[model samples]
Target chain A: MHAVRNIRLCTKDCLCLYVCPTGATDTETGQIDASKCLSGCRACVDACPSHAISLIPAEFPPQQEKTVSVKNALLTLAASKMDQEEIASKLAETTGNPVLRQLAEALGKSNRLMAEDMLRESGYMLPQSRTVGELLESLLSEKQPADFPEAAVKRLLELVNGNTMQEGKASAFEKIDY
Target chain B: MMRKFVCGICGFVYDESLGYPEGGIAPGLKWEDLPEDWICPLCGATKVEFKEQETVIPEEKKQSSLDEEHQEKIRELSFKELSALCSNLSKGCEKQYRNEEADLFRQLAEYYDSKSSAAFEAQISDLAALIEADLSSGYENANRRAAAVSDRGALRALTWGEKVTRILSSLLSRYEKQGETLLANTNVYVCEICGFVYIGDEAPEICPVCKVPNLKIAQIQRG
Candidate 1:
């Protein structure tokens, strides 16, 4: 997930802190846990006063099907080392703790696994009401979930169609990882 | 006529006209109006816990909402009644952003003018009670929520604590406006494949260093 904070502009009014469900965005630190950020529930994107935050993508081609079933998706997630070190360094610099640095390293080892988990449980992929094609097209390889869960997709249609579901507490990464 | 009284504790508005109490409106009511179990939906405080909204009886009455003679008597209300009225005035004062504490007191005293004795005392004791309930209940709720969300053991392991750093970085960064560079005293990092700002010393392992296959070492200076 593309979780990064544009710290240079944030005001520290804590509007984001107050609003974030997972406390992913801390009022005091202005850093968001890249790992904990919801797959596409960009709550901080709008709550940010300075507009200093944006989510980026992990893999390039996203080689698996846009909506790969749980199993294949898991394979791709295991492949990349990604920028785990740079992100770890930044986090370590901010936290001044080696535990998170070590944790980040371990997560890097499992980034693909976590990503697959995020994708599998991602509401976009759940298909409670939608088709595979509809779900696949909605994944934002680009920055915006803009036109996300394409209108053609049934499951994508469900947030508008389904009963207002309580947003689940943990995302896929939060679920199994715990 | 019905008035909407907003709760100081929960901001829940009681629109007396809305049949919250099936029977009808009663001023200074403790009757069958508000449901006995109608706790604050947000925090669950009972109806008995709430008092009717405070009325800030005007100080030097010129226009009479009441008959001329009655208005005079209201103005001449004893010190105790007057103090109780002032306490309500303070509660009824509109809460605003950036308002000073002294201004609230000023607004409170603005009621009941020279004819009213400054020595007036109505126990205003109810004021203490309302405040006590709010503090006791409010702080306790906050504590419970804080505990529910507290990260312990491995749950703490997965967290990024990125929010804390982001806040400190913003606080530390000297910028004139959002997204605009002030001194540009920041670090530069490149996506090896994509060229996104690494914003730090070394290149990110993945092409979130998006420009290069593997990152190249580079330094950025303000132009």
Candidate 2:
């Protein structure tokens, strides 16, 4: 779903290359192949800053295999970046040592870099929006339990691993994974 | 040597070395050399938006955009705007990843934990919390803090704080845009029969393109 960076305005940053998980964007072609892209993943879209990239949804029949790596990458990037930022700020507030503060800042910068890479490599296309727009939209559209209910997660795990439940309390419809 | 002009609206740069062939859409092309039918190589801004890659200094015109003294109308940041934010974030993050030398930043960290490893973990966690707040906390939440900002123009103009906030907004749903500023999330419907997309909320009984009645709404899905 990722679009190509504007060569004229790219600044040759290579952030997109680092963020990409599948290496789908590593070629000299500099453009993504639609067929290799995971269905509905929008990682690279969220990473581009030049507004050069976009995600075009596959029309007609939707693809069966949903490639979730992009989503996974975003979640990890967001979580890690957010973590480093919080840690850095806290250390800055409480610690007196300038060294600790500097380390925190470094961590923060790394998270930001990873997030950017994810956005550049993320390849989802939404109309009138860049790749990042599509990725963020997907984040909202996709649902998670308790945003992370242990039981819900377990059930999903069960589904994925072919585990059978105790057959009580929750109905089959409840088994429907978000 | 090449002369270039950057498009503020779209991050497109026009390089005179490539010389658009009388072409407006494609940069680095001569307006005269291009084929008559050749379209823009980028976003297809058409020929009109291209301004001269000027050598003269038009201080007033140039400063207007960068200085931005006048408050922007603050049109609701649309899903379209999200693209710009995310792409910018990509560039920013990429810059971070490539940073090998831990200069002033690493020097600031406290490495005296049980070990350097633990110290790194603790530090990362704290940073994560700060970013989480930026991404998750609403404008109203910021308002409660007495430092919260609601105006898009003011927020957009921020140097450091708003950069994170804007990035946070990029992660948020477009539906989160509340108040009158919201873009109505509007889209025009186009009739396949005549190929007219209605630009407004209500579908007119007659088609704008073919005057056809009860025209089927064009399935124009917004990204």
Instruction: Give stretches of model 2 more than 4 Å off.
Output: A1-66, A124-178, B1-223
Interface RMSD of 2: 21.9
Docking class of 2: incorrect
Number of the top TM-score candidate: 2
TM-score of each: 0.17, 0.22
Which CAPRI quality tier does the interface of model 1 achieve?
incorrect
| Model 2 C-alpha lDDT per residue in residues A1-178, reported as the tens digit of each score | 2344445455555666677777665677656665566555556666766655555422211111212322332333334443444455456555665444433343344334333333222232211223323333444465733422234223322222222233342453354231
Model 1, A25-69: lDDT tens per residue?
753555677656776666777777788766643311111222122
Cα lDDT tens digits, model 2, B61-176, are 21112123123232222222232333343333233231221221121122111112223435433443555554454222222222221222222212123233333222222213
lDDT of 1 by residue, B1-223 (tens): 5555543333455666563443344444433556543544322223533344555243342331223222332112232222223332232222111123223323333332223333322221232332243234422332232223341311111111111112112222212122334224444432211112233334444432112343343434332
Question: DockQ, in order, for the candidates?
Answer: 0.01, 0.05
Q: What is the lDDT of residue B61 in candidate 1?
A: 22
- TM-score of structure candidate 1: 0.17
